[model samples]
Structures are given as structure tokens and as C-alpha cells.
Target: MNQLKGVVSHHEREIAELRADRELAVAYLKAAMESLDDPDERAAGLLALRTVAEAHGGLGAVAAEAGISRESLYRSLSPKGNPTLKTLLAVLKTMGMRLSVEPEHQAHA
Candidate 1:
């Protein structure tokens, strides 16, 4: 292995790692979902999900399993996209995960 320059870009390396690690995939998405709640970081959140989709499963396969067209999934997961709850659930389920609710930490007054 005699290489002077890195062959794969950082993003490609990240995607490869995510594909290999399901736990990592879940944690990454969990953090990303928080951003979805913030208006300013919504696009970044969507992009994060999109990246996981590309890693865990290709967009085409995920879309098919989720009962959506590939093109539609692409549009819905795009950076500017605002996905419906159904779409979000479908995507998560397709990725072998599900969303859950937990009590947020709040100070009792």
C-alpha cells in the first residue's frame, strides 16, 4: 500500500463506515433528527438522513421497500425537502429502525 494521496474523499469514507456500522447509523440519525426540529438547521438534518439512506440501503431499494417511487424519495429527502411523517416513518422502517418518544428533561417548577 504505497499511496501518496487519499483515493476516497472524506464523505465517501464516512458513508463506507456508516454502511458497516448499524449502531453508528442509528446514533447519527438520532442526532440529525434533533436538527430537524430547528428551522435553521432543518436542511442539514434532511441531508443527514439522506446520507444514512445511501449507506444502510441505496435510495432505490429503500424507496421500493417504503412503497414510494425512487424519484419521489429523492425529492422528499433532498436538502430543501420537507418530508411527511409517513415518509419519515417509511424511511426509518426501511432502514431497520423506528422512532420513539422519551420524556425530555424538564425542571419541575
Candidate 2:
């Protein structure tokens, strides 16, 4: 049990550190979001956002920057969360990111 706990803690720290690199974090999250057709990918994307938030300053700081309560931020970032566009955009903005769209294919149908 202690070994498992240690492993979890170690991984959490690694994720926190990995998110320190904005480019990597953005790329990772963008890739995750790009796979939205898969349920697991959606969950992974949300979790990635949570991890990035943790790296930036944890939920409390993110919530403060986004002008939302910490609990709300946590709930919004949870696996089952379906945050509104406003909430999503606000959180992303606080993280120094914005949503962008590009053609899915080089040639249009």
C-alpha cells in the first residue's frame, strides 16, 4: 500500500512538473482534445486540463484567476464535468491559453 502511495505521489509530482512547460502542456492537451470521439480521450483531456491547472498553481489559484470558486473549478474539471463555454473559456484564459479551430482536413469535402 505504501509503495502504491509513493508511486502515485511520484507520478503526480512528475505531471505537475511536466505542465511547467507551456508548449508541452498545450500540445498534450490539444492532442487529447483532438480525440474527442473517444470517451476515454475526453476524460483524459479534462484530466490533462486539471493537471495543467495544478502545475500552474493548483485549483485555488486557477479559480482565483478565473474568478470562480475553488470547488466550482474542481467540479468543472472533474472527469464527469461538462463545463459551459464561458467556464471553459475563462479557465483556459486564466491558464494563458485560448481555443482555436483549424481545418480537420487539408481538402474540404
Candidate 3:
């Protein structure tokens, strides 16, 4: 049981490090947002932002870059958070990324 916990912790640490990369972080954020129509997935996207913030430079630094209070960022990024578009754009900008739109594929009805 202890070993399993250690392994999980180790993997989490690795993921945090990976999230620090700009490319990977962008991809992760995009994937999360793309799945946001589902409530559960939306929560997961918000959670992913928290992880990315931590990876980039912890919540404090990310919040500072986004010109928002750390507390607000924390609350807005929480699992049940509903951050506004402004907040989301600011955070993405702080991370040196931007939001882009792509047409969703559809089949003829």
C-alpha cells in the first residue's frame, strides 16, 4: 500500500514537471477546453489549469502575472470554479498562450 502511494506521488510529480513545458501545457489546456461541454470534464479542465499554474510557477506567480489575487485564482481554478472569460484569457496570456477556435467536425444530418 505504501509503495503504491509512493508510485502515485512520483507519477504526479512527473506530470507536474511535464506541464511546465509551453507546448504540452497549451495542448493540455486546449484538450480540456474542447471537452468542457460535459460538466465533469469542465471541472477537470479547471483542475488542469490549477496544475498548469503550479507547474508554470505556482499559483502565486501565475496569479501575479495575470494581475489577479492569488486567492481569487485559487477559488476560480477550483474543481467547482466558474471563471469568467476575462479570467481565462488573462491566465492563458500569463502562461504565454492564447485561445483559438477550430471548427468542430459534424456529419450531415
Candidate 4:
């Protein structure tokens, strides 16, 4: 019983750490998204995606998490590549993030 308890405790700790790491990755992605209007937004987003990919493991790992092929991930997140909405959502989900929208404000005269 004591050994089983220890095992459970260890697993719990590991889960907590994973959750924290995931939160950090989500924050990084958000920042990258917000930087989209900047001159280097594309590069920044790619870098952030790469970092998240590395953290989660690698391209293959991220692809697996996204339920797609490694080649697909490479193409979708590539600088000149275009990805469909489905692919984007899958990748975001793999990175523990999601898409959201907010209303844009109109300019006052």
C-alpha cells in the first residue's frame, strides 16, 4: 500500500509539472500571436512554435500530439506554408492552446 501510494504521488507531481509547462507554452504562443502586427511577427511566431515543439519534444512529437504527420506539421508551420483551419486548430490543441476572437473597436471621429 505504501509503495502504491508513493507511485501515485510521483505520478501526481509529474502531472502537475506537465500542466505548468503547458501553461507556459500557451502563454508563449499567445504572445507570439499578439505580435502578429509587428514587422517580425511571422518570424516570432515561427520561433515560438519551434520552442513549443521542442519543449513538447520535436516536430514528430508535436505532429503526434496534433494527430497529424510530421511532414504536415512542418509544412503548416513553415514560413511560406499555408494551413487550413482544421490543421491550425489541431496544432493549437497539440500545443495546449485554442483560438479565440474579440471585437475590434471603431475609430471615433
TM-scores vs. true structure, each candidate: 0.87, 0.79, 0.81, 0.62
For model 1, the local distance difference test gives 0.90
Q: Candidate 1 on 1-109: residue-level lDDT in tens?
A: 7876758977788889999999999999999988887899999899889999999768899999999999988999898898899999999999999998867668989
Q: Tell me the whole-model lDDT of each prediction, alpha carbons only.
A: 0.90, 0.79, 0.82, 0.68
Q: Residue 67 error for model 4, in Å? A: 2.6
Task: Determine which window of 10 residues in candidate 4 has minimal summed lDDT.
Answer: 1-10
Query: Model 2, stretches more than 4 Å misplaced?
Result: 1-10, 106-109
Candidate number achieving the greatest lDDT relative to the actual structure: 1
lDDT for position 78 in model 4: 73
Question: Order of all candidates by lDDT, from best down to worst?
Answer: 1, 3, 2, 4
lDDT of 3 by residue, 1-109 (tens): 3354345575477457556566887787778887676886888889887887778878899999899999999999998898888999999888887888888878989
For every candidate in turn, the CA RMSD to the true structure comes to 3.3, 3.0, 2.7, 9.1
lDDT of 3: 0.82
What is the lDDT, from 0 to 100, of the residue 84 in candidate 2?
A: 76
Clashes of 4: 0
In model 4, the clashing pairs are none
Per the 3 Å backbone cut-off, how many clashing residue pairs does candidate 3 have?
0
Top candidate, metric TM-score: 1
